[model samples]
Target: MAPKLDIETYPGNIINNEFVPTPNTRHSINPATGSPLFKVPVTRAEDLDAAVEAARKAFKSWSTTPFSERAKLLLEYTDAIEANRDELENLLTKEQGKPLSLSHTEMDFALSWLRAFATMKIEDEVLQEDEEKIIYSTHPPIGVCAGIVPWNWPILLGVGKLGPALITGNTFIMKPSPFTPYCDLKLGELAKGIFPPGVVQVLSGDDNLGPWITEHPGIDKVAFTGSIATGKLVAASCAKTLKRCVLELGGNDAAIVCGDVDIDKCLPKITTLSFLNSGQICMLTKRIYIHESIYDEFRNKMVEFTKNNIKTGAGTEEGVVVGPVQNKMQFDKVKDIYAQIEKQNWKTALAGQAEESRNGYFITPAIIDNPPEDSQVVAEEPFGPIVPLLKWTDEDDVIDRANALRTGLGASVWSKDLKRAERMARRLEAGSVWVNSHFDVDPRVPFGGHKESGIGMEWGIEGLKHYTNSRSLWVWKKIFE
Candidate 1:
């Protein structure tokens, strides 16, 4: 049985291990039903100040706490989250519009990440050691760290930033996206019992909260995951304070299918990569290039698979593989793109009318067949269920086209020939390139974007170092002697 939601009892801004609710509140709605799920308490400017001050004050002790002790606390927190996993998944499905199974998957990912960060280590590196001199490098935690999490994968991304920040000894304040705030706010409430006052906090608010966090003097660093346009603003805001920043921004990932690929074995994997989370993931395969030799067959079979296998409905419904768009703004953007595709009369293997969907912001998944390179479907990231399938005759030309985009977060080359796939994957200008797989990211691997996609890395030793400042120690033994 699923738990019931009660709006009045829902949580508010978490500051110093307390629920600090203001009179002003925003309705957190269910994307599938377009109904209010909860009245999320909005954090005011003063609340922001309090949260920052709390983090700053807590930093003094947290930064000095033993790394092993911090790790223990993180593990304890993960256990607490696991205890409430079912309720969290239900809330996530209601608020984020992903299927219940995907919500569970997100929670699983979040838990694994927290555990991974807990066990990870950053040790001092000895640059040189000799009779005359010894030199070494160290990483020390920055002060107050703020994480700006997007709506798409709030819990996982929040943990991605929060885990590293806390384990490295920095106090943290998370700003959850206004569109989907319930589960994250609930996590904040859960933390009160586990962490010390001010050690972990979450502030829920409207658009103004982002500016407050980025521009605040007390925040020593900002780790943001969102769109390219907003990422630029975050970078600019942090520039004034010279605050350390780790940004994971937008992606226009491309997946190339070689002629020799195993069609029967790979179709489901490709479909999941292209349409999972309603295609809202930053690293999802937004553009697909199939070798011309198998283009027609692949396109027809993919369309048939999508039409027959995939189901779209409310996330809570059984067997729902795709759900409504999370909010109105994104739904509008997707509908506008579909309108353009219709106006251009682009050949589509499967095109559904988004406007015709019942009450909620559901856009039927559409697959355009061999759209022109400059076409909207191919060039822009619809960030919806819409996917573009284009034919590729020349490997070099296709690779060039894939690299032409300003965003390069992830890409993949699929072929039975491992050497051939690796060769093509190497040429794609993405931060993470894969052969025969897409979106197979591990917490131990470094993941980030190149060029306009993002500014820094996340999810590995490199990402852990992003939370700390580097220091060098040098000693002259001869002088001491």
Candidate 2:
């Protein structure tokens, strides 16, 4: 169960680096009980303008701060988070339920984000020189930026974007999803108390507000992580200003299980990744392509492992598996998607069931067997406790089939022979691939998608570049020609 929070005191956008509850607001409720989760202010255009102005004003000085100074402050922020890890974990569980273990790991992902991004070097490098002339390349902040984060991995996505953007000296306006607002607010609380007002403005608002932020002339850049539809709209809005963008969107990730792999060994890993955070993650594997030579045998082992091993409870617990769906809309999506899958003439697979006692929009982890490639379950991201499996006899045929989708975010290949797995991973046509692993990401590695998955990248050195604009300085030798 989520820890008790005073829902009445829910806050709003952190404008000008201060938390204020806007008169206009959106209410959040626990999916399990339909009880009040927390109320966050739904900001208006004026509110967005305030956030932008604050970020812009703050950016004037923030951008001037030396890289080492920013690095020092980022380290301080990291320490602040470490001081209240447990409290933040509670916030995560209350709003977005996953296993307690995974929640803790998410915090770890945040810590590493600060540590990794802060260590980046931004020094002027002289490319060519003459007696009194030099051509220099220097990276500087792009002023204020807007980061629209998704609900699935709130802290991870928010921090991943913020860490790099801020470490590079740009002030930020983070629009976190309404489903889990408290944690982001809590992050804002920490920042406002420590950093200069407007250095980091965290806001909460409805859907349309994102477009306003992107289109706002004050914002120099935008880094968004969400669905393809919304991402497209955001891209269009940013294009009006030609502001740089780093979009990381949807992923109907694929996992290829070869005949050579041991189903018993790979089953647990696949299930863990497929259902990580109840499959709400963008890069999570939603489609499983298995070799036909051992489909049935593999299914039996995988199904048994999934049925017996997965757990559903609050993330505060020590060994809980998947927790409640983030909110009712997600619960309905999971339900509707499963109903469609079951109604289809495709072969029936083992289905997940939400225990009657479980409340707050919880659903069983679904496993579809030998489903048709055309099935929506196959093509769409269920983004829930659901897994779809398809059998492929011809390797090239299946690879082509998986590559046919609009989303090519993350993918995996499980095989005893590492060479075969690597070959298939290369052929999979996605951003990042793992051998015998699913959705295992490190702060140091570049993570993004292929095709509609997104453009540009996040959470690596490449991510730092998102907050920057490169300039080349050329000086005349010997006082001009």
Report each candidate's C-alpha RMSD, comma-separated, in the order given: 2.0, 3.0
Q: Write model 2 residue lDDT over 285-335, tens digit each, in one string.
A: 788888989888877877777677777666555666777788777778888
- Global lDDT of each candidate: 0.89, 0.80
Model 2, CA-based lDDT: 0.80
Write down the TM-score of every candidate: 0.97, 0.94
Worst 10 residues of 2 by lDDT: 1-10
Per-residue alpha-carbon lDDT of candidate 1 for residues 1-481, written as tens digits (9 for 90 to 100)? 2223332466578899998888899877888878877788788889989998888899999999999999999998888888888888988898999999999999999999999999988999999998898998999999999999999999899888899999999999999999988888878877877888999999988999999889998899999999999999999999999998888999989999999988988988898778888889999989999999999888898888888877888898898888889999999999999898879989889986687356688887899999999998888888899999999999999999999999999999999999999999999999999998999877788999998999889888998899999999897888855
- lDDT at position 75, candidate 2: 84
Worst 10 residues of 1 by lDDT: 1-10
Top model by TM-score, which number? 1
